[model samples]
Target: MNAWKMPVAWMSMVALLVGGCNKDEQNVAPTDDNEAITTATLTLVNKAVPTDTVRATIENLNTTADFSKATLNLKANTTYTGTIGLLDKTKTPVVDATEEIREKVNEHLFVYTYSATSGSQNALIVTITDKDTNPAPGPYPVGLSTDMQTGAAGTGTLNVVLRHQPNVKDGTPNPGSSDLDTSFPVVIQ
Candidate 1:
């Protein structure tokens, strides 16, 4: 082939290779968008006594947080079945953020961290009872539902963090950006 034509052919091949590499970028799925959360409610029902229920709510989370009702009063040495309800009050009809999180369970995770203000260091133990729909290596934990067990009579803080993991959730809280991070006071008697 002629010298100039050969150079043109090489340039064309390089362009084709670059164009082919961008195909995957075009086919790549968009990551899940984080939900706007305005309210977070945690309801716990005693395992032994179902009638005994403790509810805590944190409202106006995106702006001025109203933590007045955000307190969990529990009985020590008791296990409670817990569920978290998240809401986006900014919407016209009000969106249930919890349902959205459930719909994208594989892309979302809730991390519960407890710190004792008084009494035992490990005052509350929280185990996520719900799992995501991630395949094979997954079925990772989703904290929408949890089993909370109290250790001793103590006052502590329960920090609830909702992470938007997208394609990186591996049952750990480190992979994603926090969609919601709030704390609720806990009093175990």
Candidate 2:
């Protein structure tokens, strides 16, 4: 081959090799977002009263709490059917992350913990009444919705935590990365 022809052949071979080395997107696993939770709203509807509702929204998922802005106040000695809604408010119209969580219920769990005060000994109790069991090997309790009961009239803080525990959820608060950890000031009267 001529000297100029040799260089042209070498360039053509290099181009062919580089073009053939394109990444196989089929083999590349698509990633689900583990973060970017912008809002968490906990809604409680009174089963007895029917008209009463309590909503606690924790905005600014990336910052400190603004208790004055978002709080939950409920009547004492009441049973409230609690529903938690997670959202990625950074989107154009705000996307609901709860559904994505429901799709991965076996790997997700919501935990509700309350701080005890002098007036309200057992201030709050949370029961995982509803569950989502799919993507099989399932029957896991996904606490996107729950039952909440208030003991007595008191003031406390309700902390809600959503954990992503894939394949290691033994019905405990341990073993997972916290998708959202937020608290709301609670008053029962």
Give me the candidate number with maximum lDDT.
1
**lDDT by residue for model 2 over 125-188, one digit each (tens)?**
8888766564455566778888899987898888888888887876677988888888888888
lDDT of each: 0.94, 0.81
Runs of candidate 2 exceeding 4 Å displacement: 1-18, 23-33, 134-138
Model 2 clash count equals: 0
**lDDT score at residue 125, model 2, on the 0-100 scale:** 84
On TM-score, the candidate that comes out on top is 1
Model 2 lDDT, full chain set: 0.81
* Model 1 per-residue lDDT tens digits across residues 1-189: 898999999999999999999887756687448889999999999999999999999999989999999999999999999999999999899999998988999999899999999999877999999998899798999999999999989999999999999889998889979999999999999
Regions of candidate 1 where Cα sits further than 4 Å from its true position: 1-32
What would you estimate as the lDDT of candidate 1?
A: 0.94
Which residue pairs show collisions in model 1?
none
Output the worst ten-in-a-row residue range by lDDT, candidate 2.
Answer: 131-140
- Clash totals for all models, in order? 0, 0
